[model samples]
Structure formats: structure tokens, C-alpha cells
Target: MPRDGSATRERILETAERLVIDNGFAATSVDRVIAESHSSKGSFFHHFASKNDLARALVERYAAADVAHLHAALEHARAATDDPAKRVVAFLSYFENDADAIMSAQSSCLYVSILTERDLVLDGTSGQIEEAVVAWRDGFAELLRAALPGRTPAGVDIDVDALSDHVFVTFEGAFLLCRSTGDSGHMHRQLTVLRHLMEALLGAVAATPPRRRRAGTPSRH
Candidate 1:
């Protein structure tokens, strides 16, 4: 792509992501995006076959960036701690901090807004959206699985996928509640509960191992 085309593409995607987050996918229009992005109609059509095509590209582009941020967060956690469970907690903490920013009136996740429009045009946008969602869910599941060796609470037998689903649901539900109630704090509160639940479910170190006795020393009474 030419330098100008690449820049125009990015601008279009950014504008669409912002508009969709604010007004929802169904409510936003291609003309609005073109106008907001400051690109001509021909340029918009050059990069996107239609609004549906733009939606598809939006999902892929935004999802890639979002997933990359998650990966970086997890990596940073891994660097700061040797414990896998702690790394999982760190990942959630990063999201909590991010949600704090959102509550401060930053934009909510774009994918959340896009997914609500289940009637998206059948221009492959559905698959793109699904792929984006699964990518995010799987990333969390992979981390949770890594931390699941012996951390779950007693009598619990959840697979990684189940745990991932729970975490993902918590996030999506929180977003919905916050948007519906016009309460930004809803997300932070829900995520706090989620973090605590994970600690209970996946950080359950029921008991400590017995300490080793010193050589030639008497055992504890």
C-alpha cells in the first residue's frame, strides 16, 4: 500500500472504532466514518468495499491491537513474577487499571459494541468478530490453564475453557451493565469481584506443605 493509503486506512479504522463504541455498530454509518476520518468517499471505498467490509477490517485491526496489549500485559506480569498464578492475577490487575481509565470516560472496548449488533451484514464481519472474541477468550484461558496445576479450590474440577468462559462473561456482562446503567463504576466493581473469584477458584492453596525438620533436630510436638 502507498504511504498515504496506509495512513488513510488507519484513520478510517480508528474513526470507525470510536464511532461504533459511542453510537453502536447499527447506528453508525459509513458516511459518518468517512467524514470523521477526513477521507474522501472514493478513498473510503478504495479501502473498503462497503460498510460491512469496513466493519470486518475494523474487527481484525482492533482485535489485533487489543490482543497485542493483552500479550504485553501478560508478558510484563511474567517478568515481574516467577509464579504463574501471580501472573494471572497481574493480567487481571492490568485490566482493572484499564477499566479505571474507561470509567474516567475513555471509550469502552470496541468489540463489545460491535458484537451487540448480531445482525451485522453478512460480509464476513460475523466470522471476523467471532474470531476476535475467541482470540481474546483463548488468551485468558491459556493463562488460567497455565496457573491451574494445583490452585483450584477443593471439590472443583473446572477445565481451562470453563474458567476462560467465566472470566470472559464477567467482562462482557460488566460492560453491558455499565453501559445500560450509565454507571462507569459498574465495570470496576464487577472486575473486582472477578479477580476475587479467580483468586478463590484458581489461587486456592488449601494448605501448606509440612516444613522439613533440620538435620539432627527434634521434630515438632
Candidate 2:
């Protein structure tokens, strides 16, 4: 049978992504990926001409996935509620579920790793990260626009753009804290706090935080 080229490429990418996330990209050599993935030099080179090429591909793939998650969360939230405030809360809940899954796997965000090792990756990869972050800002901006009118806190002016950016700020900060503290539940807890704060700001009823998972228990994303 002919070699499954796409499967081989995906396997290499998957292996590289895991290593880059766990260990810094500067420390995860192509040789390490080859050994870990059970791929040969020729196969690895065939799929990725160089480590730089692999880094670019990784950022592209990660950015695409991040945008997809943003859209999916918005879609699901819109479907669940017509009230824009509630929809915004629902959108955040999607990420809370994601935090649980990441906690279970004991993996941090690949983007965070990429950002910390900014000098190692190409400039284009940084652009991809910027684009993903913008998508998130715009996504939240849309929801907040619809939800904020007539609901803004008394005597307070909310900049839609700044408020939208806060969503990303909160999440990325929570991830960093989780990495620093070694507390698996940190991300989910921080997300829950953001959700409640949004509820209060938008005058929506706050949803109860989901039950805490038992230690070592797996979570479904």
C-alpha cells in the first residue's frame, strides 16, 4: 500500500505540538520529535523541510483552531439564548469547559508557549497569533455590543473594544497563573469569576459554577 502521507504529516505535527507545549520550543529539537514520534529523518524532512517550517505550520494550525473555537462557542451560545447578555455568559462557559479539559491533560496553551519564546519563531507566526487574538476581541465585541446597550452599569462608560479585549486578557492571565501555581483548577476557577463579573456588569442572572471535578478525574471538552 502507498504510504499515507497526510496521516504521517499529521502525526508529526501532533507530536511536535505536544513537545512544544510541554517543553519550550527552543528546547524541543527536531531530533527529539523524530524519536518521540517514531518518524525517520527523511519522513520528518519530507513533511517539514526544517524546524522553522514546522514552527510556522504549528502556529498556523493553532491559530485556525483558536478561531474555530471562538466561532463555535458563539454559535452554541446564540443557539442557547436570545438574550445577548445570557449568550455572552454562555460563550464564556464554553471556555470554562475547555479549561477543565486542559487541566485534565496537564497541558498549557500553545500560544502562551509561542509568545514566551517569541524570538525563536518566525514573524509570520507572531502575526498569526495577533490575528487569533483580534478574532477573539471582535467576537466578544459583537456580543457585548448587542448586550450592553441599556445595560451598562450606572455612571460607568464601557469601551466595547477594551471590554472585549478583557475577555482574552482574563483567559491568558488565568492560563499563566495556572502554569505558575501548578493548580489544575486555577483556570476554571478564574473563568468562573470572569463569568460572574460579566453577569453583574450586564445585569444577567449569574449561573452557578459547575461542580468541582474530583482530583485526577478527566473532563470532557
Q: Who wins the TM-score comparison? A: 2
Q: List model 1 lDDT by residue over 12-125, tens digit each.
A: 988988898889888899889989999999999999998777887888876666566657656655775667777677767666656655454434667667666665634456
Per model, state how many residue pairs clash: 0, 0
- Please give the RMSD to the true structure for each candidate, in Å: 11.4, 3.8
lDDT of 2 at 133: 88
Error of 1 at 190 (Å): 1.5
Candidate 1 wrongly placed segments (more than 4 Å): 1-3, 103-107, 116-121, 204-221
TM-score for each prediction? 0.79, 0.88
lDDT of 2 by residue, 1-221 (tens): 34778777888888998899889788999999999888899999998878878988988887887787678778867887888888889888777766867565546777877877756444566778888889999999999999998988578888899989988888778767877888778888888898889988898863324433344432312
Q: Give the lowest summed-lDDT range of ten residues in model 1.
A: 212-221
Predictions in order: lDDT: 0.70, 0.79
